[model samples]
Target chain A: MALNQTLSVQRLDDPAPDSPIIEISHLQKVFAQRKKAPLEAVTDFSLDVRRGEVLGLIGPSGCGKTTILRMVAGLDSPSSGSIVVDGKEVTGPGPERAMVFQDFALLPWQSALENVVFGMAATKLSREERVARARAELARVGLSGFEDHLPKALSGGMKQRVGLARALAVNPTVLLLDEPFGALDAQTKTLLQDDMSATLQEEGCTTLLVTHDMSEAVYLCDRIVVLTNRPARISQAFSIDIPRPRGERFRSTPEFTELVDQVWQELKAHVTLSNSQAVVEG
Target chain B: MSSSIRTAWVAFATFLLLLAGWWGVAAIAPSSYLPTPLAIFERLVYFVVEGGLLDDLVSTMINIAAGFFIAAALGIASGLIMGVSRLGRDTIGFFVDVFQSAPSAALVPIIVVILGFGREAMITIVVIFCYFIIAVSTAAGARSIESGLHDMSATFGASRWLFFRKVLVPGSMPMIIVGLRLAMARAFNGGILAELLISIRGFGGKMMYFGGAFDFASLYALIAVALVLTFASMAVISLVGRQLIRWT
Candidate 1:
């Protein structure tokens, strides 16, 4: 399409293909409370996401994994430290990154296609080009026939598909997924994981996925970073070392199981420690 | 279609029941005070056919429409500002709270003293009656938009104009429309009340003329006309609102 032709020639200042596209150094976030001591959420957390690689962040619930993702997406500011994306220091949200929320935050009043188009509002594309790109992205996510449906008319999985399509429609340099499939049922989750893996391979898009599900992290991520309890710090980092386009058969393999188990074992220690701490505090 | 037909039948049955109740009450009450349904119906026919009440009805409608449209414009604009800005909330929203709680009819005499008992005074009374409720409800609607949507808009790097047009306005529409429906009801009450108190004009004037002449049937007829007009306008607002937010 003419729109694709224009987009293909749009990226003139791209960095080296193998270089890190996003660098987060020594990030910290604190939540202030009235008449009480301020709470620390994330501290000394840092990571670099290489171009065209899927990185996963996993931890127990409320471990600030999503907080780190929001920081990278520029939806929230860090209390200290810095994030550089595409050779630019991030001060606020920009067109370089798009987030797929866990809640499938599609605008209830907009159709699936319009929601996708809304994401392209920051781009320099014309109205027709925006509509064309939106349609193409929606079709890419298997929502061609359902473009006119509102988010409420869609099931959980379909809604997330629209969310994914919206993120992808802007041709963002980095895609941020905050438990994108966490709200779906088990069966739908499995189906979407497979589709997501295939789509990531096809697009070769850089991604930072925040999820608590160990198996999901193992299946999709090239590298997994496990975080500790609140005031989250990186506790462990594991490389999947598995080949790309890993299929459903890989989920049954001993290698996948071993990798998932290893991550789970690392996460279980933090969970136990936080649970005991919670008991004491309560 | 079938459900709509059933709704119409139910409405017609209710109307008949209400008329029967009124007729029974009329029999026990003094005839001069509470006219029978048939007597009121005859007076209604007279008004429609030859009583020159049509001109009064048109003038009252004009006052109501002018007052309501002006109030709506100012209310929605100020309401949006109050909703999104802290300063606006503290200032405009503060007065909205005060006026909404106080009965607006209490201000009609003051309004007459200021605007001096005419169409302008009547319209000002209608504005005073309707504005506060619309502003209050619109502000509440604006405040109730989900935080996630705001975050989503920010992440997309939406411009302020785009955010207002696409997110803030549409997100707050359901409540804004609800406020409009309520304000419309108040508009009718205020317009008629102003006409009665400030000037001998409109349907209010006709009612006053009938009441002074002991024509209870004509007074009741005018009251029924007002009731029908209010219900019809409210239904129209509801229908338009439903069409606009079908996605919800």
Candidate 2:
């Protein structure tokens, strides 16, 4: 944890270290169903993500963490409130933000390289430049020879690699990940986590990661925010004291386990409470 | 044996079995309505060589081609419109649903009455038979495009035109191809039905002439030729469709 102390001192030295790259304020979302009552998914959720930092949102499944990420991505408009990225207020999806989905939403009809190139469609780059960038991004994600493979041909982890490459190809200021590794097997998830940690360090892009995995949150995020069950609100926030560029060996370390355990304890209480309340209400 | 070789062997065996079965039935049956395989083969040779069957086959194919292409253009355009817009879906999609469910073959008589007993009437019946089915399938394909892909397009700030061109159109292509294949079969049926009902022309006319003269072997031969042609055309469509959606 000595690295945490050094980073805090360094943060004090910087002119505006506290300034946020993404500010989400009073975000609310209610899904209106045709024959059922409107379901409130998020209420008054607020957070500020510092530049070049990984911020993780962890909660029970279906707790509106994904809704918040979607709202930030501008794929779903908030019922009320605002999201400001960099300096501009986000009215809809803009060039500055890109989202990596849980399902690795590569177009089934497109090759891996083409899927990456698609992310840059809104950019001012020429066709040659776009193709060049797409190839480079695919190479960066260790998919050099697999560029022509469709999504169905690729493994789950490989598909996510394409998803990550696509998001990064756009050169976004903020990256939104919605449970990116939730679908992968355990071994693949660990391997991806290691690669992701290294990649995030290299890219140094501000990222908002929504995941229910406590260990993943502790490993990848600088800060973790836990939310209550449906109509999610911030229940707890924890800062991981570990240094960056965490490796596979870090997963066995005492600090890593300690942070994960702490997040789990906070998260477990909420999950239990929500489960009991649901039983009673039903 | 290799899979392809095994498949070829099975197909060859099946053809032989079918021919033997048909021969057995023709030997037992009293009426000339069931012709022997050898008789039908001889008649097919005569028609192809000297009886002007080739000219009638070419003309019928032209009608089917023209009608299918026209149906495809109208179907795809309207289907895409219905897919993307609520107004389009409610208005045009409603009518498509109604017409698609109705017996399209029954409408051939009405079309013949309106356009009269001509090539125009035949083409009209073919178009009517095909248009609704293609439109219905295309709309379904467009509507069923993955919602995640839409989100991906939006997140990257893609323009409406760009999304339509790159994502919506390509995503709906598999369904469009499905629609086209089905429409091709319907076009053939319509072309034949129109020839039978409106006027004695094309292969349908040849069949009527053979049946009247009690040339049962020639009728069976013409029917076999038409079946072979239909199968060949369908295979061509499937090949083109496979090429279009190679990713799937």
TM-score per candidate = 0.93, 0.92
Model 2 in CAPRI terms: which quality?
Answer: medium
DockQ of each: 0.65, 0.69
Best candidate (score: lDDT): 1
Each candidate's interface RMSD, rounded to one decimal?
A: 0.8, 1.0
Candidate 1 lDDT at A102 equals 94
* Candidate 2 chain A minimal-lDDT segment of 10 residues: A6-15
Best by DockQ: 2
RMSD of each: 6.6, 3.3
C-alpha lDDT of all candidate models, in order: 0.88, 0.87
- Pairs of residues clashing in candidate 2: none
Worst 10 residues of 1 chain B by lDDT: B26-35
Q: Give me the displacement of residue A177 in model 1, in angstroms.
A: 0.5
Provide the lowest-lDDT 10-residue window in model 1 chain A: A3-12
Question: lDDT by residue for model 1 over B1-248, one digit each (tens)?
Answer: 79989999999999999999989998878468888999999989987889598899999988899999999999999999999999999999888887788877788788878888778989898888888878888888899988888889999988999989988889889999999999999999988988888888888998888889988888989999999999999989999999988989
Candidate 1: stretches off by over 4 Å: A1-18, A276-282, B1-12, B28-30
